[model samples]
Target: MQQLLAVAIRDILPNKVRLAITRLCFFFNAICSKVLDPVKFDDLENEAVIILCQLEMYFPPAFFDIMVHLIVHLVREIKCCGPVYLRWMYPVERYMKILKGYTKNLHRPEASIVERYIAEEAVEFCSEYIKKAKPVGLPESRHDDRVGGKGSRGLHVITPSVEDLLQAHLYVLNNSNEVLPYIVQHQHLVKQSNPKMSKNWVLKNHNKTFSDWFKDKIFADENVSETLRKLAHGPKRNVITWQGYDINKYSFYTKPMLTVNSKHIR
Candidate 1:
């Protein structure tokens, strides 16, 4: 399939679209091998068609518009047995990530719409899981002037609720299915590293209350969020850091993904 796309892309006029065509072919090839059958091919084909149509819109004179529409229709011909076959395990998110990378690389005129659409779709997908899971009740505001700071009112310092935990869990699960196994294997490290810090530390040591700890430890940590974002993109290798932290490089779970690298490539 990749070879076929590589050849077809060569014929696409406008060097930028041609390059995008080539990369997208490779991206699809990587994803198609993993998706559940039947629905997988059709959805992937449809996605490819959408991208091609975007390209055609940019370069209509190349007759790529007809090719784009034909490809879109071909997607309907592929038959699948189950709905799961249509649903992507991680490919949808990964595809959007790749599109972002591709658009950045190409610097094309019409790529922003495609990039924005893909990113928005990814967020929508994440929101679905958020809706399904309960929110983790992390502290939002502090109360004491000494601990909470100037003019704060909220009384109790709340910790991340179950929803926040679940959101983090599902985000990791859907994005890097492989990381689960690794996380499971090293759950000990995660438990130690992510020990539920006491509110006292935030109040006395940091001059803030438990509420501050909740917000700072869970929600306000930019590094942790960035790490989650990376994990959401793809399966990453669990690189053991020198700091004696043997946690899953991507997720903070006890189990790791089942053949994380292979599952990702497939």
Candidate 2:
């Protein structure tokens, strides 16, 4: 069963980073399930293996939860785009909420450890990751009461403290990264094309305030109510990445995003 699972994983994982994550997940699950039959999931390079092992020690099951949270978004999209019956087979939204709450709580301790590691090591891994990452445009910018001006294209840098970073990750688990992939990977087409309006689109669309949107659209689930409350009351500009793979926003400096130059990136 484990061998078959490994084979399937190799087929699905599209890159080195995803492969590293797969191997780490495989290791964690194998250790927990006591699968000791000489599995060959350790085909990762030396550096990748070391990083995965470090992540395992630094995060344990918490890292797995974070990875699961990111993957859930993709899985949800797949279901949404599939047949109606297939959509019912996966409780994507409800599972996402559960994973969000779980991942947020998991990182509480790790953020503290990350904070300490960054301070002691004097490495700005978080900043480095952010610098390397191509910025994504905000989706459907609306006028902000706080700024009292029309929003323009720019990076939304939300700086958070160590504890706040942990909380942010939890909050973001529910908010999928719809803009990043579109903007970063396919910039020309998006810029040239005027996107067709959806059949369900509305101009004034019974406009809901932030609180209104939170209550009606977002906050029906009671499982994450406490966390949501914290988020509602807390700051948003800079926080830890709970759900998304964008590591730049995370509080830790040691676990930066692995970047290669566009020329070198394969």
Which candidate number maximizes lDDT?
A: 1
Error of 1 at 48 (Å): 2.4
After superposition, candidate 1 runs with Cα above 4 Å error: 1-15, 27-36, 39-42, 65-67, 80-266
Model 2: per-residue Cα lDDT over 113-132, one tens digit each: 55655564565766676765
Collision count for each candidate, in order: 32, 5
Candidate 2, clashing residue pairs? Answer: 158-237, 158-238, 159-238, 165-240, 169-242
Query: Cα RMSD for candidate 1?
Result: 26.0
lDDT of each: 0.49, 0.43
Please give the range of 10 consecutive residues that has the lowest summed lDDT in model 1: 243-252
* TM-score of every prediction relative to native: 0.22, 0.15
TM-score of 1: 0.22
